[model samples]
Target: MSELGLPLSEQSLQQAHNGSREEVMRVFDEQHFGRHHAKRSVAQLEEELQKAYKNFILANEYKSSKLCEALYTRCEDKMDQLQVLRLPSMAKFNAGFLLCNRSFEEECVGPSKTIYEQRMKKMLGKSRSLFIKEYNHRLFNWLVAFSLVMVVMGRFVIKFILLEIGAWVLFIFLETYTRMFWSAESLYYNPGWHFIVAIWETLVYSPIIDLDRWAILIGVMLVILVLYWRCYGRRKHGGSWLLPLYRNHEGGSNRWRSD
Candidate 1:
């Protein structure tokens, strides 16, 4: 009730304070039901009364502390009821797997900025700074530019340079995530139908969903491909300039042949 600063909310809370428990509950239910604008609600109202209990505790608190145990009680029962109705996936009110938003521990009450890799998530989404942080590294960018120029000249195999090295970093991250269950308490900890719903929220977005992005990415990929085909920076006799392990040696012309 302290959180309700709005005039309407204050009025509703005041009404609850003055009315009988049953009357207060009826009003609360009416407000919740009307707020949702649900024509026909499928989920059952929770019989365990919370609003009434809150009022009861507050009214009796001045008399004795022993009569009220508000601290031990859950606070989001109304919010939870509204949330169940808002979810649109099922015919009946139910959360699916992977993204059920259910937690073993209680979530925080106040809004907090979400951080990803030391940058604010909202900023990262709105800007290219996170992905292109290395643009200031002149030597690295120069090398990449040189490689792309080589790709344009006629050696197609140069594209593999990044793929092979990138795989090592990707492998390390994947291995770390696979072992994260102990600390993170991943959905992997609970295997059932609901677990599928729990994971969906985490995977809310993917780049492939947008056709414009797909076309732009494909265009860039094609350009990179053609450049690589023209200049892969391979040796005269054939072999990668950077990767020597698979290079042709002793008059062997086969670039892929490793003796």
Candidate 2:
């Protein structure tokens, strides 16, 4: 109360009715009045004054307290602005409000301690359960998203591997046909183990698929794709896995460059 320019919490609560907006603003400014803590204070004041206002009306106070009305309105506006915050932010604001208004709670005690204690327990338990449910909901959403991503990546990887193997199969067929044409009379060129061995050897040495010889090539490509969208294929019409070598058809003073 001293910090708020009033000796008693009740006096501070009624300060606005006495035309002391300056004193209230001064107190807030002096406290640094950050968004979270300020909202917390406003929320506490709103709840307390609402109860007081109800009691005043019940007692047939014909003239409403201007100070209470103004204070309540101020707190209500701040709380409305603070509605953008989620559960965690709201919880933190509530905590700060409780801490800041500890003096008010200590000064004003209702006649029934048992009723107050029961209400406090019920509110705290309900709040705890609500926050726990929110946490679980967020966790479940994240897990579902993660699972979807994993499934997509897994499918892509499997497809890529099968395509690579199919490429190797095609290359073997072409190589065997070419060798038969090159050495038709040779014993090793006949349809036998020698032809299969030759295709295997060619695949091992093939410049196009040299990286494909390793089992972890799929993992390597995934890393590369993530690092550079389109991987190393950021060229006109999108480049190949191995960039195509185009013939130099232009007649000029010979000039060449290497990547």
Which candidate tops lDDT?
2
Q: Pick the candidate with the highest TM-score.
A: 2
Report the lDDT tens digits of candidate 1 across residue range 28-87: 567665645543331323333455446544543332222111211222232233233212
lDDT of each: 0.36, 0.43
TM-score list, all predictions: 0.21, 0.24
Score residue 218 of candidate 1 by CA lDDT.
Answer: 63
Compared with the true structure, model 2 gives a TM-score of: 0.24
The worst-scoring run of ten residues by lDDT in candidate 1 lies at 108-117
Q: In model 2, what lDDT does residue 117 have?
A: 40
lDDT assessment of candidate 1: 0.36
